[model samples]
Target: MDKRINDLKKMYMDIKIPDNIDSIIDEGVKKGEIKMKNKFKGNLIKGISSIAAVFLIFTVSINASSAFANSISDVPVIGKLVQVLQFTGNKAQGGQVTDGVDIGMISLRKAKNSEEVIIKFNKSQDNIAPCYSISYEKYPYSMIFTVSGVRKFSAEKDFEALKQSNFISDSYNIITLDDSAVRFAINFKKPVKYEVKEYKEPAQIVLSLKECEKGNDKAAYIVRTASYPQGETLGILEERLCGFENIRIVKDDKGTFAVEAGTFESEEKAKERIKEIMNKCGSDIKLYIEKREANQLPKQMQ
Candidate 1:
């Protein structure tokens, strides 16, 4: 009997366990069994079954020593003995365990002639790559900013304050997604250009928006209605306005393509044409009267 007990101890000692042995044990206890508290100490060969006694002793030992339980919880039939323990439960909860580490509330700071937006986190998240997506829209002329890998974000107070700033003329909307991402739909008084910068230590993302410069020449004037990034939108604009005379698709230094309906000798003539276009295209289309010297006009338009 002594030799048998020694052999059982040695056999279990060589078994290997899993990292999530505690969770597995908790799941088993939730099903029915009472958790063992005291170390096993009983007669080796009492009027009970030897195998049952040895199994109970092993279970009690596992419950008493965390290191021992972790070392042998994955051993073949012994591992499956917990009933609730399975191969995939450990991985299923891994994301939830790590989701707490992420960016938190966002704030906006109004600067003279510009605005600065900052993202804040509980601790340094320098190791995580900040991924973002951007979209621009016409009519009211708005830009959408979507940032991923954020745990939470609140912009109510700062967004309200930004609306009152001289640089921001309209309201903004913020939406938090199910996958820990945030989206911001922002409208400006006029067309603006923006840039993004990042900082470590406390882990912050800074966004700056400034009004885009049109030009300084003033000998002639053009009725410019809309601008789009130099791609599909510009191609569609060109096709839509192909029948109109004096329509020019001009690419700016910032890489945006501006659509000019016509050039006139005076701002009044440009404004008059702008009114006609606005009436035809609907009130949402806002046009800008851009001044240009005779020499600055594109050779084709001149």
Candidate 2:
């Protein structure tokens, strides 16, 4: 009787599902027959006690499983269901809610920074706007880009705007740059005259450096509002220089020669002279514009 008890104990301990399943299936079939025999051979009270323990364990397991399923079903909507299962049992902290249609759960790989977090949401199409937002745990700023709806393919500026083009704006705490103080060197081939005119008032004038030169002494003829093409402008420039009134030749520090004209008293008089010259010079030479004496007058003359 002792030998039989020892054999039954060995059978109970040894009959396990094997790592290699085919072998485990074969062993299970053999063990099932032995277990059946032992059931009959064992004392009635011990057999009943063992059966009761197994039933209790099974009942507890069924109840626990039902409770878990019930908890999952209590989620609010399909979107919430997808969100809950997104990390496959892992919970996402600081996860955002998106606005549009959600297809399913997507696995997010581990990310190092907020930029990576924004990229992850961008990859998922539609509903991305409401679903995701970015935050750095230790940092004060939050960063994110939201899409309003399904994006259609186009070569418009709208698509370009979606890209992380402005890094400063993407970060929460942004320092603004002042571009107002920037200055650059501007060059012009022909002389330009600047005037600040307050309607019907005597205008203040600033002359380009070229207007200060002296050379040819002829009076200039000017025309108002004439458009000059590139090919024809050179001829007009030459005639203006040659025909200018009280033209003078001046020498620069570098010994370059320059042609200057006019110490005319008023802009109207200088323009009248330029117009007379334009009529003499003809239409083949394009006339771009005529500046008032106020603009063309040298600082010494002013």
Candidate 3:
């Protein structure tokens, strides 16, 4: 075994060694280590930069969402996206989160006689439930309808065209109040007295306006049963009076929906009809003499 080991050692020493092999090997190892370190550092920097860029983009998107919501918040269908992100209040039927208001299309027309202006809300198409809170403010030459729980307005082609109608002395504007309300600014040539009417199945709102009357004379007389909230009461009244002609649902300036049994030119005539109305519709009927302008009489009375 000793002889075999010595022979093996002599053979290994006899093999010729390459010149500068150790230095070459050391240099190659050092180069490989440096290259590996450089590659690792480059990858680490790229990963960090990518993470930073993604974070920045995400932050900017969240911040910009509100501003974008304000601009197109009144556009139907697409507007709900903004409402979902920004609105934290009541939600509509279709998961549309709103401030509890959803306003739809508005329309204005002049009566056939051209003495009264009729403004209608094409509200049925929109998902607005019956009897939402609708109020109005009287300005110098404009009447502003502030409707609550409305998120947007979908303008009908006819209503849109009416914005340019000759009946309107000045232009009307629809402004968004928030995620769930809207204002309809109806501009006219002068101060006017207006009445509101709401219907059920079709889900419509009507604003009838006439120039203010002078003196102590009342414009027209209407027999009212009672004042109720805008929704179910108005609908019930409409159903109850469906069989009668000339009986209509009318709202006063105070946003009260009352049943107007009849309209007459004189108070005496209106009072006389009250008895007949009471006999037909129970004894709860009351008389209302509206001081409306001469031209502002209801279509039937006019």
Best-fitting candidate, measured by lDDT?
1
Instruction: Give all candidates' CA lDDT scores.
Output: 0.52, 0.31, 0.48
lDDT of 2 by residue, 1-302 (tens): 99999999999999997679998888899999899888777767688889999988867765767533443452232131122212212112222333332212111111112111111122233322223211111010111122222132121222223333221211111111211111111122222221111110111111111122332333332233232222233233444556554332222123222223433445677566556665876655433333332212211110
Worst 10 residues of 2 by lDDT: 197-206
Of models 2 and 3, which has the larger lDDT? 3
- Predictions ranked by lDDT, top down? 1, 3, 2
- TM-score between model 1 and native: 0.34
| Residue-wise C-alpha lDDT for candidate 1, range 1-302, written one tens digit per residue | 99999999999997888889999988998654432322122343343578888898898988886545644642321211111112231111001112333555455555456766655544324433245555443223345555565565554346666566444554444423235565555555555666655544444455567877742424677777455654556455554555565554554334355666877888888888877766666576556877755323222221
Candidate 2 to native Cα RMSD, angstroms:
29.0
Q: State the TM-score for model 2.
A: 0.16
Selected candidate, larger TM-score, 2 vs 3: 3
Model 1 scores worst on lDDT over the 10 consecutive residues at 89-98
Q: How close is candidate 3 to the true structure, as a TM-score?
A: 0.31
**Candidate 3 per-residue lDDT over residues 67-150, each given as its tens digit:** 334324423321111111121121111222324333444554444323323323334344323333333322213444545555
What TM-scores do the predictions have?
0.34, 0.16, 0.31
